[model samples]
Target: MARYIFVTGGVVSSLGKGLSSASLGYLLKSRGYKVKIRKLDPYLNIDPGTMNPFEHGEVFVTDDGAETDLDLGHYERFIDINLTSLDNVTTGKIYSQILEKERSGKYLGNTVQVIPHVTNQIKDFIKAKTSGYDFIICEIGGTVGDIESLPFLEAIRQFSNDIGKDKSLFVHLTLVPYLKSSEEIKTKPTQHSVKELRSLGIQPDIIVCRSEITLPKGQRKKISLFCNVNIENVIQTVDVKTIYEAPISFYKEKFDYQVLKHFNIKNKKQPNLKPWYRTKNIILNSKKEVNIFVVGKYVDLKDAYKSIDEALIHGGLANSIKVNLNKIDSEKLKKNQIKNKLKNADGILIPGGFGKRGTEGKIQCIKFARENKIPFFGICFGMQLSLIEFARNVLKLRNANSTELNKNCIPVIGLIEEWYKDGMLKKGDLKKLGGTMRLGSYECNLNEKSMVKKIYKSKKIYERHRHRYEVNIAYKNKFESKGLIFSGLSNNNKLTEIIELNSHPWFVGVQFHPEFKSRPLSPHPLFASFIKAAKNKK
Candidate 1:
């Protein structure tokens, strides 16, 4: 049986509950215990697939085609685990399942209520498929006291009671605001947050305080006394220069020690943190720097491309180089400004996004990178745009664009009508906007002589994807005649997966998202190779 640790936030959102859960999972894993981390989102949306980037950040795609919260990316990167659709649950998903069950008469015409039906479903979701792990760390999304999170709170409250107190724990994260004017740290919000949690019948076993400065022993003791937690269990997590330092920082504060003590497990061996220390040192002491421009529609909000941003950093970590990312807003870019704006960029990256918001500008950026011999890497939508750029400039197709943006064009990129997922032939639906894409992981076979093959050193690889359109295979020969190599194809040899310019220095576009698999300790091969090429460009 796996022990449970429910992580909840208080006072405000974005307090790094996901990071805290991931850090703890990493610590336990280092201690040679099997662990898994899950995110229980309170949003009513079935998934984040249809949500706007500004509204919900990136929609992370798991291997099993679940478009989940971006925090799953944090969890995967920190713990180095590949999660599944079962790992993420949302209110919308829960309610929809229950309504389906009721419609199917699974409840036998009983009144479908929140207490047993909803709470039981939530509990079943948590405990399902969790037999082999030693610990299951679940991070509850949204802050406490929100009406949407009420049932989830109640479910967890009941969950603790049913599972016995010895096997369940709650960790509450709250902000410890530092008022510079008064030069005093306030603990009332944390106290009130705990009070709110206790009102819901969930007394937190530990309180993780997020503060700008270290909490003095006096404040720690005060928080312990007011929140009714042990003084030693009141852990402080000060802001660090890099998020990679989180596990190490938490370990320094004995956060993991307190957690183990609560479980009454007697393991005195310390976690092996040399990899984290080395990564931190490299981040702080790298001498060589490469400026990579991330041209995208969501440049205004860095979180919109959270995984890509972190993957580039992971690339730099693998090469002992400092990556300076220049986020360029594609909407504001003009054709004439491309050269001057990217003159100093050693490499250029275009991340995946939907709609035709700033696509013309992205095409211009790709053209500049290709013509100037700069290291260029493209992903998903980026790959489609690269195909369009090649079709227009090289093949003399005057009007080339994706069918998603324009109905009448060269159709360099168009909707993939059908694809195989889990051995089922899934068809694309024009009416649905949610969960209707060629998603999850798929296999691609690499051409033996391709640059990507050299980088990966493998003939076959599986990468995660979240897209509706693909490069039109009807134009493959035309593209190849113009020196654009379709270097990779799907297992059936029907879909184009990767493309490269035979004459260019380092230009590669992939239809699948390699950024999803990049980690700090072991960077994805494509990212590591891209960073190496970018460094050589300097």
Candidate 2:
């Protein structure tokens, strides 16, 4: 039987529950156990595909096209595993399944209630994803006392009994707020939070206290006594300069060892955290720094582009340079101030987003980069707009625009209503916004003597994508004749995957999201090249 560890948060949200679960999985996996992490979101959205990035960070795309919570990104980065759609479940998805079953009379006219019906479905959803893994760490979204999370909370409570105590564990993460005036880390909030969780008929096996200062010995013992957990299981995760230090910090506190002891699993091998040591050293001691300006629509919320921001940092680590990202609001940027905001910047990057909210400013910046030979990297929507800019300015298309933005104009970038998928051309219908896009990983073949081929140093690559429209392959020949090189194409050569300017310094745009695959120890090649170009420009 597969062991389960359900992680829940209390007192507040954004307490790094995802990171805690991922770190636990990392530790267990390093000790020679096959592990996978799942996210149980209580939100009503079937998936985060259509959600605003400003509200919910980046929608992490699994290899199987599941638009999961951004926490799944943390899980993938820490565990080094490519998760699938089965790993992410939401209230909307669960209710949709239940309602579908009821409508189909699969329930046999039974009144669908939250007790056995909903909870059983939740249990099955959790169990269905746990086959072939020794450990399954499930992170519950939102806080413990929220009403929306009641169903999931109840399900996990009953799930522990169904699976037996020895095969299950509940890890609770809560805040231990410091009273600055009194200069003490009060444990009352954590106590009450655990009390609330217990009221729901679930007791936490471990309490991870998130605070600014490390917990004192007396406070740990006090928390253990109050929460009815072993003192050693009360792990301290104070604020750190880098999140890569989290596992090492918890290892020093023997957090994973306590988890092993609770599950009665004797580790056959010790953990190998040497890679993290290198990450820490490079992140802290990189003497040379490069400035990269990120012009995007959602500048107010940094989480809106969390993965992109982290990828740049990873790229910096790969090149032994510290990357300083200056986030500029594209919608608010004036044409005259483009140089002012981007002056002395080594490179400029435009990340992906939906709608036509800030296309004009993006085009202006792209024009600046192309005309002045500044290093530029454009992502999904970024890639689309780059083509539009080239068509209007260089190719003289005059009224160039995407069908997604203007359907009646020159459509250099058009919707992918009918495209090849798995080597077959299929008619597409994406009237709804949710899970209808061409998502997940796809194969791309690089052209010989192309910039991307030189960077990747390979003839073919597989990258993850999450876009509804694609560049018009019909104009591939004409565009290439005009010096706008189609550097990368799909496996079937039906879609353009990458574009580059032969005459510019380092101008490239990609249809896939390479940020999802970037790592701290080994950044994505495109990002490393982009940063290298930016550093050289400096």
Candidate 3:
């Protein structure tokens, strides 16, 4: 039987509930307890796949192809756990499943309602997935009073009662705003937030207060008294310099201790946080710094490039330097404005994206990087653009383009198709949009004496991929003859990856999402090498 901790946010959004949950999971895992974390989103979207990166940020893809909320990425990085599609659930997904069953006559005309139908579905999701783990940390998306999140809250309240109070606990994350006019910290919002939560039959056992300044003893006691939680359970979560410091910082504040004490988790040994501590030292006290420009469409919202941004930071930790990222809109390059934005950059990176919106700009950036000998890295769609740029300018192929944009692209760098697990072809000679692509981790054999091989220090590597079109094999020979190297390939001799200008300073690209696997304590070798190359350019 696993003990459950349901985390909720109140007073406001952006309260670091996801980080808090992840940090607690790390502490529990360090104590030799098996743990799993789950995220319940209250949004109506069945998945984040169709959501705009600019509107909702990056849609994190799980190993099993679940387009999930970005918080799941936090869970994976902090706890070193591989999350699956089963780990994340949205209200839209739950209701859709139930409605699908109802339409199929599986409901037997029960006149589906929220109480036993929707709420029961949520409870079932929790109970079915939590069988093996000793502790299940579940974070509910949105604040307590959100109308969209009511069903989820009601389900959790009933779940706690059904599982017995001893087996479940609730942690409320609320804001402690500082009033500049009064020169004082306010606690009224938290009181009201708690009161709202209590109205729904859910009382938080612990309160994680988000504040810019440390909450004084008097303030902490007052919050505890009004919020109806213990004084020790009122954990203060102040902002830190680097998010990697979260595990160590929370440990010092006894965030894990309070959690264990609430659930009576006795005799649990402390976690050995040597790796995190070392990473923090490398990031904060490093002697060097490098600037890298991230050329992409979703530059306004930082979360759109959340994983890529953090991966660069991790690379800085690996090389004992600070990474200063300059977000440049790729669309600006179509008008020849990218050069001004990238003039001071030590390196240039083009991350993955969809459609042909700003692709011309991306191709122009790739051309500039190749010509100027700038340290360059292209990921997924970015990799395809690099090949297209090389084909059109260097090889002088007049009709080079990605099949994604034009199905009849002459020197097709991207083709609409699906390759199977056993080297078989699927949707042969047919084009379908929904779920027709190579997704998840796949092995690629790296050629010896190649840039990728040298960076990885391994002949074979597996990386996560999420794209449909690949470099057309028919054009492989022509591209290779023109100095473009197909240095990494699948076992079937399919060109799954590429690198360029071996004699040049630094240039590489891959058709995989390496950012998905990078961790603060363990930076990806490619990013580390790219940053190192950038530093050398300085």
Candidate 4:
């Protein structure tokens, strides 16, 4: 038996609902309770895998290969939990499953509508994934009145009543915009958002007011009276210096205490939040600093590389330094600008992306880093382009390209048509580009003398991958002949998992995303090492 906390946002999207939910989960876990955070996206996309990074942000992949919303990344980083595919759901996925079941007569030849069919499915999903967890915090995506989210909203409403009021709690997060000119924080948006939620027959057990300034005297009371929530239950979530401080800030406001009080669950033990406090101290007191320029396609949106950005921050924390991250949009960079922008940087990074846009610029940047001996790190597409750059400049393969870009040329990179698993080279189907790819955790065997192996201090390690194309294995020997070390390979020795420059200061490209595994307490080894090298260069 577990308690359910349904967290929904209003006024507008991108209000840190995910962060708040994860922080609450962290607070709960600190109190000796098992906690799991889930994201219920209202998007019609089956998963964010096929979506553009500029639009939907990073498609966080679980260890089980489920492409989920970026909010799951926040949940994972904060709660330190390895979430599963079952932890995330979307309108597209739910509808796809329902249609499949309908076609198979799982609905018993009845007309399947959104009311009972969709709502029941949603309830079933929530209950199914809650097994063995003491607390499940589900953050519903989108605003309260979005047409796409109505089914999910109604589903949770019915669930709260059906499961009894004591078993579930609803937390509504809405904005209370501050008018600097008027010197007041308005609560009309919060009032209306709650009224809309009430129209759906779901009254929030707790109302979290998001504000830029402090909640003025009598504002909580006014919000409580108008929103129909108790004054003590109206919690103010103010902006913090760092997101890692959110759990502690909310704790100061007694957010979790109110939640537990609502549930009437006696405190079993006090929460140990020293880990968060310690990390915050490091961030606040770091004396040293280094600049790490990240050149990427989706540089316009920081969310596109949220994990990468955070990983770099964690790397700085590990080294007791401040990481100054500069985002340069590769699409707009000229040849001279690449050198101009990167000349002062201690480190350079190119993250994962799709398509051919800005690739030449990315290649130019990689070449500059390679020749300058700047500590460089490349991920997925970044790794692939490095090979192309190496082949063209080092191996004299001027026409080298990936099949994903040019299907007919000399393919240094090509689609992963098949993989050897369970003692078999299974044939692949490339008909769909949905959630299908070499995703999640896969073992990579490291060469004993490689720099990557030294950093990881392990001969065999597993990292999560998210790519449709891979470095062609046929060109391994030719690439290795040119001092392009295939430092790490898959368990079958057929897929290239890691690449490195043997003579450079610190140059490494990985097919898998190490950023996905980085944490605040213990940063990813690759990033921590990369930042250390950057510190050395500075």
Candidate 5:
């Protein structure tokens, strides 16, 4: 008997519905209610796994291995909850399941239609998964008027009736544009957006308005009158300095009070949001700043490097400093013309990516970092490139290459691999393209005297990984002899988890995605240490 809060956006997309939903969930949780957030994407793609980062932003992977929308990343960071594949759904996945059932003759030769069949599947999904929680805050992707979202809207509308109106509430987020020439905020867009929702048989209980400035009392009353919501329930959301400040800001605006009143839940103890407020103050009042260059192929889209960016920010927070990130295109460095771009950066970081394009540039950047004794951190493919650079320069392997690029490469960095997971062989040929190599979290045993162990202050640690190729272990001793310390290894002693340079001030590479687990309150240790080292370089 969980109460449902359906969140939808109008006027336009990117209205911060995801953040708003997460903030609401946080507020509700603080009031002593069990809360869970779910996302319903209207896209036809089964998941974001195969989509390009430029097209769709970052594909967030869950503990249960669901490649989900980047908003799930925000959800996890805000709530400290580990989401699973079941937490997100798209039109493509819903229809694919229905079609499979049809193909198997499970429908008994009935003609399939969007209404009873598709909508039924959607409703079933909602009802089945959301049964036990106190509040299930579901955010619908896309705007209200989009054609792809019509069925989802219909399903939610019907679900409200089925569950009774008292148990369900709709929160519509809309943009209130301010015309600079007129110097006045317009409410016409929100008025029309509400009209659209009303046409679809859904009435919003709360209206979260996004604007550059606070709405005047007159404008708020006008919107309340037109949209059929109380003036008190019409909340204004202005731009904040940091995303972490959202909960505190919204709470001050009485967002949780409105939600509880709408759902008829008694308020418990007052929320203690001092931690979020303190984090924002620390970021805003920092006296020191350090610039770090993140070299990657997906520089055009910030979401592709979402976790990495946040982790670096967290690092800055740990040191009470500001981290100014310079997004450097790895492809541009292929011509050896990026010296000017690298000049002012206190540290250089090469993040993970796929394919062979721009890899040589990444290797070149690694060489530059190593030669200059700059603080450097490499991840996944970045780690592989570091080894390749070391092999070419120090090992004197003239044509050092990865097996991913040159399949027949001598002393290949990539090899056809098999992993023993719980004594079972998940067989897949190395030649195949999709879903190979090590994925998800695995344990790594850190060398006791290594820099990584000292930084983490632990002998055993686990981190999430997403990569296809690994460094050839046969070259381990040779590379170690050349001063590359094998700082971390898998429990079985076969896979390398971390590597560092003993002679350099701060240089490390990890095969896992540490950024995925970083938070504003709890920065990842590696990033915190890296930023500290970068500050020292300054």
Candidate 6:
């Protein structure tokens, strides 16, 4: 049986519960214990699939095509695990399933309530497909006192009793605000937060306190006394130079030791955190740096491209260089302002996004990057825009654009009307917008002589995608004749997966999102190559 560690937060939001959980999971995994991390969001959006990036941040897609919360990105990066849709559970997903069961008469005319029915659904989702794992760290989203999260909290409380306390552990993360003027840290908020959690019938076995500075011995004792936790189990987490240092920091504090002790499990081996230490050292001590401009619509919100941001850092780590990301909002970018905006750019990257809000500005940026011979990388929507830019400038196609932006213009890119997957036909609907894209991992065959093939050193590669539009293959011959390279193809040469410019110093675009798979230990080949190209340009 897998011991469950339920991570909950209080006092405020954005307390780094996800990171804390992932770091602990990494610590245990390094000590030869099988570990898995999951997220239980209290939101009612089914998933983050249809939610706006500005409101909910990036929607992380798993290999099985589930659009999940951005925290899953942190989990995957830290634990180095490939999670599936089953790892993420939300109130929206739980309620949707319950309603479907009710409509299908699965309840046999019984009145449904939140207690037995809804809570049962949440518990079931928690324990699904979790066999053979020594530990499962489940982070509950939202703060402790939020009304929407009450059901989830109650569900976990019930789960603890049902599974026996020995098989369950609750780790509560709370903030300890430090007043500069008073020069003292406050533990009152943590006390009240733990009190609130206790009111929900859940007592935390460990208290992870988030603070700007180290907690004094007095403050730690006070928190332990008020929160009803052991003094040794009260862990203090301060801001680190980089997030990758979190696991090492927590390991030094013996956070994993307390977790193992709680279950009365003995592990003789120590955690091997050499990879994290090396990654952190490289991140902080790297001398060379490259500036890259990431032009996108959601640039204002840093979390909007969380995975992309991390992936770039991973790429830089692989090259022993520091990546300076200048996030440029495409919607506000003017044609004349391109030079000033990207003046120091060693590389130009256009990340994935939806909508036509900043289409023209993105195309303008692509044109500047291409004409100036700056190393450029485009992904998903950015790739389509690159094709449009190429068609308008090189192919001399008048007013070239994607059908997503303008239906009347020349269809340099158009909606994927039909596609084949595993010998079965699939189609997307223009009316419905949720969970309908060509998502998850797909295989792409690389041209033997292509630049990507040289970078990846493989003829076939699999990448994850989350888009509805594809470049028209009929223009491939025209594009290839004009020095454009359609270097990768999927679905038996019908879909374009990668594109490059033959004449430029380094310009590439990929139809799939490679950022999802990039890791610090082993960065994705494309991002690593992109960083190397940027460094070479510098």
Sorted by lDDT (best first), the order is 1, 6, 4, 2, 5, 3
Per-model TM-score versus the true fold: 0.96, 0.95, 0.94, 0.95, 0.94, 0.96
- Candidate 5 per-residue lDDT, tens place, 25-118, comes to 8888877888888899999999988889998887787766678888888888777677777889999999999999999999999999999999
- Minimum summed lDDT over a 10-residue window in model 5 is located at 418-427
Which candidate, 1 or 3, would have the higher lDDT against the true structure?
A: 1
In the range 320-422, model 2's lDDT, one tens digit per residue, is: 8889889989999899999887887889999998888988999999999989899999999998899999999988998988878887777677666533333
Model 4 per-residue lDDT at 392: 93
Q: Which runs of model 4 end up more than 4 angstroms from their true locations?
A: 416-436
Off by over 4 Å in 1: 418-436
Give the worst 10-residue stretch by lDDT in candidate 2.
418-427
Model 6 TM? 0.96
Off by over 4 Å in 5: 334-336, 415-437
List clash counts for every candidate, in order: 0, 0, 0, 0, 0, 0
Error of 3 at 323 (Å): 0.7
| Per-model CA lDDT versus the true structure | 0.91, 0.88, 0.85, 0.89, 0.87, 0.91
State how far residue 503 of model 4 sits from its true place (Å). Answer: 0.5
Candidate 3, residues 1-538, lDDT tens digits: the string is 7999999999988889999999999988988888999999999999887899988888787777667888898999989898988888999999999999999999898899999999999998877766789999999999999999999999999999998999999999999998888889999999999999999999999888888888999999999898888899898888888787888888888988877777787845888899888888877887788989999999989899999998898888888888988888887565457677678889999999999888988888888888899999999998888888888897788688876787555645544353321323443533442246667777799888788888899999988777877777666777778777889998777555666666569888888888888888678898888889998999
Q: Estimate, for each residue in 197-297, the C-alpha lDDT of model 6 and write its tens digit.
A: 99989999999999999999999999989888999999999999999999999998899999999999888899888888888888888888999889999
Instruction: TM-score winner between 5 and 6, please give it.
Output: 6
Write candidate 1's Cα lDDT for 1-538 as tens digits: 7999999999999999999999999999888889988999998999999999988899999999999999999999999899999999999999999999999999998999999999999999999999999999989999999999999999999999999999999999999999999999999999999999999999999999999999999999999999999999999999999999999999998888898899999887789899999999888888889999999999888789999999999999989998999999999999889989999999999999999899999999999999999999999999999999888898889898887898777777766553223332345533342234888999999999999899999999999999987776778888888889999998767678999999988899999899999989989998888889999998
Cα RMSD of predicted structure 4: 3.1
Model 3 clash pairs are none
